[model samples]
Target chain A: MRDFDLLQPQHLSDALDALAQNDSAIRPLAGGTDMLVDIRAQRAKPDVLVSLQNISELRGITRENGTLKIGAATTIAEFLKHPELTKHDALRYAAYVFANPMIRNSATIGGNIGSASPAGDMLPPLLALDAHIELVSKNEARVMPLSDFFLGPRKTAKRANELITSIQLPVISYQSPVSSLQSPVSSAFYKLGLRQADAISLISVAVWIQRDGEKIRDVRIALGAVAPRPMRAIRAEEILRGEIFNEMNLKESARIASEECSPIDDLRASANYRRRMIAVYVRRMLEQAWSKTQ
Target chain B: MQKKTILFSLNGEPREWSVYPNELLLNVLREQEFLTGTKYGCGIGECGACTVHINGEPILSCLTLAIACEGKEILTIEGLAREGKLDPVQIAFLDQTAFQCGFCTPDMILMTRALLNEIPNPTEEQVRDYLRGNLCRCTGYASIMRAALDASVLNAHRSVQSNEE
Candidate 1:
């Protein structure tokens, strides 16, 4: 940890002003779980750290106009504790397995996204939820889809002067009547880590499906650690969306998802292994989500 | 970088310390406050060796900055005992011989206390899941698991005794 100036802003506007300093080295410090480690390893050397911990405006979960708005500073522990979030199983499951209890107690949703790691546990679920990120700077504020936010590993579309304010997720009801199966949205998340807890994902998958009668109304398949960034399998999604819900279509969708991701051989797993697991997990998640819809 | 004084309550004592922006809470506690019970096993957040309770939640101190501790209530392993008596978790660890090397004991005990605080009597799976971050190379986790369960029972007994009295 090299010496750096610390700016503790009690207000979001103050924090934004601090970041608005034109200096690219001025970085917003959320949960230090990732940033501090990077700093200790000398991977990230920001000249100034604008602490967002004190900003009350960027810390909570709220629902407005059918959107689940999660403040960027909301910790993983907070995410799990929120009663309303339990319905979002894919996001909740991801939060449950996000490192160990201690790390989760401190790690923030925004920090996870801010790190923009390919293997970030929260990425796949957020992508599957079709989350929109709200970024605020001194001059202006903007919202963008989570898919377009990530440019590469540790890289994002967020400007140097901006701070991520909140993540907005569309609320979909998963508990519609089983008889009619009217607009019941179901989702599932799966992560193949080295160990049960405190392990980074070797490959992760999240599936979100909305059923309309006997057909798939809308569907999203997001894969992590199998690409340059957490990405949606659009080609695979196309195969299942608006199509009749069946085993054959699910298998084809899974196969296409495996083909769409360009995973590289890493220390944890080989590219071949990741590609195969993507197909397997995608299929499993699809099956799990479909069953939930019933 | 300019050093700033932060005021916070540590182990039931309110103290002020001037620290650099880059100073981690772990280093500040050990060096500035002389509360070395919070061990520094891994500088990263992976290992829970530097675990401490801020506002009653266990978090890795290694990854937390000292300045962030301002106006927050911090509880370290040294704060667990009261009136010269060890905490229930500490007593259970001693009875169970939960540690062989004792390097990870402080954090393990802290985590168990925090766990029991949340779930009065947690199941074996829950205990393992909750304390997974606090890695112990010794004892193979069996004794630690026993200690966590025993601590829950001890806590129950203590509460009962207090209720009766």
Candidate 2:
């Protein structure tokens, strides 16, 4: 690996200053699981390395005003341990199947999202949850929906001077148990990997739904590993939303979602196999989520 | 390229090295520190052959930068045995013959150490989850799994005996 100056910033503001000064020449090191791999493989060669380990503010999970704020440096293991996060089935399940215990101990959700892999385990769940990223720079800061944060594979909407501070997810409230007649919000996530652990996704699906009696009031279906970016199957969601989630409708939505993706034949799986698995996984996720609402 | 004095505790001993920022912890421990227990397998984070404890958590040393570990406490396979006493995990592996080629032994032991530290009595599924990254080509993991369970029991037994004394 080529040598670079490691910059250990004492303050978050100092870190932002260094990033702003060096621009693209500096890479923020979080977890070091992904960054170190890229550096060793000659895929990334940043002249200066900015270590964020000392930035205490970017390292915990918090909730306020019905919004969940997870620091960008929070590890996957930390995400799994949060009591409130575990209650959200989609988020909990994604964390459960993300890599293994070793990787999760160091792999941060921010790094996972920043790497912008279309097959990122957190992307599907974050997309389904309607999460937003808080990006801060030396001069200013801004927040954007997580769905719009990814431009393509390994590409993000973040500018060179900006550092992702936190991921904000609005807590979805379920119908009160006292109102037994009202429908409740439910979600589910499923990933199809080559092996049980540490394998990247062949295809993955997540669904967030709220039902009114037998009809789906609102729904969002996110698919990964079958596209250049983790994306919502908007047309499929449109078809399923406000419609009775019967066998025929659910099957049709799944078929549409599968057909909408543009996947290539990769080393892990074939494009055709990915499409089929996407359909199957999406159907299963939708069924599971629908059942949970009942 | 820049170099700095990397100071950290290695196996409970203070160690320092003047090295490049890009130097991997696995290489530094094996080459500079002359601690070769942690083997380099995949060079990437895919394999846990170079797994070590950073302040108590198991991470791939090959994927970790030496300079970034300035203040962290590192625990490798060499640290498992202290004052001529073998760790229960080491004894269990010896008794069960957990390894054949023994290439991935240190990694497995260190991973098991971290696992049993976290979950004193873990289920079979938990053991599988914890050691999934550490691959063993010779033993095929059956004996290793058995040894890990035995290690848990032995550790608990040792703790009880010490407490009684």
lDDT of 2: 0.89
Q: For residues A1-294, could you state the per-residue lDDT of candidate 1 as single tens digits?
A: 688899999999899888877687898899989888888788988999999998999987899999999999999987688987777899899998899998998889999999999999999999999999999999998999999999999999999999999999987545554455544788999999999998999999999998887899999999999999999999999999899999899899999999999999989999999999999999999989988874
Clashes of 1: 0
Expressed as tens digits, the lDDT of each residue in A1-294 for candidate 2 is 877888888789989989987468798999888888888888998989898888898878888888999999999888678887786789889998988777888889889999999999999989998899999999998999999999999999988888999999897666566676544788899998888988899999999988787899999899998899999899889889889989999899999998999889989999999999888988999999888876
Instruction: Give per-residue CA lDDT, model 1, range B1-165, as digits (tens).
Output: 998898999999998999888898999999978998998997887778999999999999998888888899999999999879889999999999888988899999999999999999899999998998888887559999899999999999988987999
**DockQ of candidate 1?**
0.89
Looking at model 1, residue B123 earns an lDDT score of 98
- Model 2: which docking level applies? medium
CAPRI tier for the interface of model 1: high
Error of 1 at B140 (Å): 2.8
| Full-model lDDT for every candidate | 0.91, 0.89
Report how far off residue B131 is in candidate 1 (Å).
0.9
Tell me what fraction of the real C-alpha contacts between chains A and B each candidate also makes.
Answer: 0.96, 0.78
Best by lDDT: 1
